[model samples]
Target: MIGRLNHVAIVVPDLEEGARVYRSTLGAKVSEAVDLPDHGVTTVFVELPNTKIELLHPHGEGSPIAKFLESNPSGGMHHVCYEVDDIIAARDKLESDGMRVLGDGEPKIGAHGKPVLFLHPKDFMGTLVELEQV
Candidate 1:
């Protein structure tokens, strides 16, 4: 089952500008952009009291974010991540309930070095949901 709200991801056209808006304008603590080549994104985290805001930009021509940006040129909320104590159990339960899991339906290492799984947006009211093992 889901635990806490992990992070809300925002796909941005420019990672620098996104970080600037969160850091300089909002006076937030933002981390340096880290390239996640495997995930096809460059990300920066804006620390918050309860959760984090992840700024993501396309890392390569074939990146998924690139495809997302094609439709939403100005960028937008990409996904919401929630923590889970047992991701395998959660996945099994979700599958039994007829929810589709993205990719190979296996947990992958996420930005925080935790096991993560992405659920199909259609299964969750048009919002792509990410489950991260805590």
Candidate 2:
């Protein structure tokens, strides 16, 4: 089962500009950009009182984010991550309930260095859902 809201990911065409908007305009505390080659994204986390906002940029031509940006040129909300006590259990439960998991149905190390899984967007009302182990 899902736990607390982990973070909301937003795809951006420019990672630096996205971080700048959060840091300067919104006056938020932004973390340094980190390149996640496995995930094919360069990310910046905007810290907040309750949760974090993740700004993601495509890291390579084959990056999924690159494909997403091609469809949504200006970039947009990519996914909502929720915490889970046990990612495998959550994945099994969701699978049994008829929800489709993405990417070979295995957990991958996420930005927080926690195991994570992504569910199909169509199953979750057109919104991509990410489940991260807490």
* lDDT to native, each model: 0.93, 0.92
> lDDT tens digits, residues 65-93, model 2?
88889898888999999999999999999
Candidate 2 at 103: error in angstroms?
A: 1.8
Candidate 2, poorest ten consecutive residues by summed lDDT:
59-68
TM-score of each: 0.96, 0.95
Query: Positional deviation of 31 in candidate 1, in angstroms?
Result: 1.0
Query: What is the model-wide C-alpha lDDT for candidate 1?
Result: 0.93
lDDT of 1 by residue, 16-134 (tens): 99999999999999999999988888999999999999999999768877888888989999999999999999999999999999999999998789999999999999999999999
Give me the runs in candidate 1 sitting further than 4 Å from their true place. none
Error of 1 at 20 (Å): 0.8
Model 2 TM-score, all chains together:
0.95
